[model samples]
Structures are given as structure tokens and as C-alpha cells.
Target: MNDSQALGRISAVVSENDVVLFMKGTPQFPQCGFSAAIAKTLSQLGVPFTPVNVLDDHAVRQGIKDYSSWPTIPQLYVQGEFVGGCDIVHEMHQSGELAQLLRDKGLL
Candidate 1:
């Protein structure tokens, strides 16, 4: 897909899923440390999320970064909102804020 098409797809995916992870690979086979860390955190929290592997598609890999303007992989979206990457997620999980946020969204 082209850039515009990829962005459109990303938008659709984000809106359709309550929680989405735009990562480098599948959750079960994450290609990067950051991606694996976040995936593990979510799993431990029992949060059901959709994982989009950017590694399989160049346009999507680049498009997602542009869409979120975060310049990073493993971007998390909760209830259609950008929820930062690994370090931010790790901190939130440690502080109990991630669970709180999920609860607030009626996701947990």
C-alpha cells in the first residue's frame, strides 16, 4: 500500500480496536526488546490487544510513525488514543497508572 493507503489502514485499525500495538513483529515473536517488553506487560495485565507487525510492510512501518508523530515503533493505542511507547508504558505499568487508565476506559 501507498503512504496514504497505509495511513488510512492505520486509522481504521486504531479506531476498530480497543487496544492496538503497532510493533516490529507479532506479540508472540517480537523482533525488538522494546516491543517484547510492552507485549509482556500487557500480557501480564491481561489486557487484550491487537498487534500490528510493521516489519511485514514498509509503508505501514513508516506510515505509523508519521501517523502518531512519535518516531518510534511499538506505539500503543488505547481506545483510539496514542498511549506512548515502551519506556512510557513501562513507567505507567510500574506506577499503576496503566491499569487505572484501562479501568477508566472500561477495558479492564
Candidate 2:
């Protein structure tokens, strides 16, 4: 897909899923450390999420970074909002803020 198409697809995916994770691999088998970290955090919290493996599609990998303007992989979207990446997620998890945020969204 072209850049515009990729962006459209990303928008649809984010909007369709309550919790979307655009990562390097599936939650069951993350391709990178950063991806695994965020996946594990969500798993530990028992949050059901849709994991989109960016590695499977080059267009998506680059498109997502542009879409979020975050310049990183393993981006998390909660109820169609950009959450953050590994370090931010880990920090939030440690501070109990992630859980609170999930709860607030009625996702947990």
C-alpha cells in the first residue's frame, strides 16, 4: 500500500479496536525488546488488545510512526488515543498509572 493507503488503514485499525498495539510482532512473540516490554505490561494487566505486527508490513511500520508522530515502534492506542511506547508504558505501569488509565477507560 502507498503512504496514504497505509495511513488510512492505520486510522481504521485504531478506530476499530478499543486497545490497539502497533508493534514489531504479535503479543505472543514480540520481535523486539521494546515491543515485548509493552506487550508484557498489557498482558500482566489482563488487558485484551489487538496487536498489529508492523514487521509484517513495511508500509504499516513507517506509516504508524508518521500517524502518531512519535517516531517509535510498539505504539499503544487506548480507545483511539495515542498512549506511548515502552519506557513510558513501563513507567506508567510501575506508578500504577497505566492500570488506572485502563480502568478509567473501562478496558480493565
Report the lDDT tens digits of candidate 1 across residue range 30-66.
9999999999999999999999999999999999999
Across 1-108, the per-residue lDDT of candidate 2 in tens digits comes to 999999999999999999999999888888999999898889989999999999988999999999999999989999999999988989999999999999999999
lDDT agreement with native, every candidate: 0.96, 0.93
Q: Candidate 1 — which pairs collide?
A: none
Q: Give the CA lDDT, 0 to 100, for residue 80 in model 1.
A: 95
- Could you tell me every candidate's TM-score relative to the true structure? 0.99, 0.97
Off by over 4 Å in 1: none
